[model samples]
Target: MSIQVGDRVPEVTLKRLREGLETIDTYTLFDGRKVVLFAVPGAFTPTCSARHLPGYVEHFNDFRSRGIEVFCMAVNDPFVMQAWAKTQSVPDGLQMLSDGNGEFTRALGLEMDASSSGMGIRSRRFALYVEDGIVRASFIEEPGQFEVSSAEYVLEHLPG
Candidate 1:
């Protein structure tokens, strides 16, 4: 089953390119924090680039003002994620994370087989609002859709 509102985030190491390639575990990123983690099927793809990531980039402060740290995650390598962040002009505080092997995605039961598109295993488009290591809300998009997981939607539906 997919991760639910009350599920604890799984422990897995995700990569991010900051000063260097860094491996951060789920516990460190989510424990005792309010976070909005949005996943894309692939970085730099059409909707993800034009709408998804940009939406977060545009509203990074809106989330932060509410005391939530935002993170963008994809199945691509850290290098691609870093490049996408640069190209998108992502804010410094909006973290770009890499689940290169799809371990984290699979652990959440959100992995999709995109082999037909030559992307292989990838994350489904979804967003989660997590507080102190437990999911407070989850917005999982239907296949080939983008409405529910958008930054605007997640922000509107965040639990009080």
Candidate 2:
């Protein structure tokens, strides 16, 4: 089963390119934090580029003002994620993370097989609202669809 509300985020390391390639574990990233982690199937894809990431970027401050940290994750390498971040003009505080090996995605039962598209294994489109490492809400999109996982939907449905 995929991760559900009240589930603790799995322990796994995710890569982020900052001053250097940084390896951060899920615990360190999520513990004691209210985080909105939205994952895409790949970096630089059409829907993800035009709508998914940009929506979060446009609403970054709204989340932050609510004391929530936002993170964008994909099944691409750290280099590609960093490049995509720059191209998207992502805010400094909106983290771009790489689940290059799909470890975390699989651990959450959220990995999708995109081998038909030559993308190999990827994360399903989803947004997770986590508080202090426990999931408070989860919005998972259907394959080939983009609705529930959008930033606006997640923001509107965040638990009070």
Candidate 3:
């Protein structure tokens, strides 16, 4: 079953590109923190590059000033994630998490097979608002829809 608002984020080890291939434990990452985590099917795709990811990057300060840690996650490898960060000139505070094995994505019940599109197993675009590790709100997109998961929408729902 898909994880819902009351559910804690799943325990998983995801790789991230720091100065090296650093591992992040999801449980450790979210503990005692309010987090805004967004997932995209793949990096460098049109909608993701143009709007989804950019929306978060552009609003980084709004999230941080509210004391939320902003993370952009994808099933792609760390190298690609790092490249995307550089390409977009992502501000220093926002994080890019690489779920190369889709462990975290699958646990959230948000993984999808995009093999027909040559993208393999990927995440369905969605965003979550987690307060001290409990999901406060979830905005998931339907197939071919990008309405609710935008950063602007998530901002509106955050407990203020």
Candidate 4:
């Protein structure tokens, strides 16, 4: 089943480009912290670049002020994730996570077959509000939909 509110995130490794390529586990990343984790099918896509990603970027401080960390994930490699970060002028506060092999995405039951679009296996658009490794809320979008998983929606729901 796909993850839900109150579910513990699956233990899996994801890549991020910091000073260099750094490997991080979902277990560690969400441990003892309030995190807003958002996922997209792929990075650099139209909707993703135009609104999804930028929404998070623009709301970095909104999350931070609430003591939450923001994470953006995609089914792309670390290199592409890093490049998109730069392309979007993402700051240091928002982390770009890469589910390179889609293992993490599959583990969370959020993988989508995008082979017809030449995107191969990808992540469904979703966001999770996690605290101390347990989900506080989960906003998963329907296929080809962008109605629920935006930063504005997450912000509206975060504990004040």
- Candidate 2 stretches greater than 4 Å from native: none
For candidate 2, the lDDT comes to 0.97
Candidate 2 residue 89 C-alpha distance from true site, Å: 0.4
lDDT tens readout by residue for model 2, 1-160: 9999999999999999999999999999999999999999988999999999999999999999999999999999999999999999999999999999999999999999999999999999999999999999999999999999999999999999
Q: Model 3, 149: alpha-carbon shift in Å?
A: 0.9
How much does candidate 1 score in TM-score? 0.99
Candidates 2 and 3, the one with greater lDDT: 2
* lDDT (Cα, tens digit) per residue for candidate 4, span 1-160: 8987778999999999989999999888999999999999999999999999999999889889888999999999999999999999898979899999999999889999999999999999999999999988889999999978999998997765
For candidate 2, give the lDDT of residue 98.
96
Question: What's the TM-score of each model vs. the native?
Answer: 0.99, 0.99, 0.97, 0.97
Model 1's number of clashes is 0
Clashing pairs in 3: none
The sequence of per-residue lDDT tens digits that candidate 1 reaches over residues 50-159 is 99999999889999999999999999999999999999999898999999999999999999999999999999999999999999999999999999999999999999
Give the range where candidate 2 is weakest over 10 consecutive residues by summed lDDT. Answer: 148-157
- Candidate 1: give the clashing pairs: none
Ten contiguous residues minimizing lDDT sum, candidate 1 = 148-157
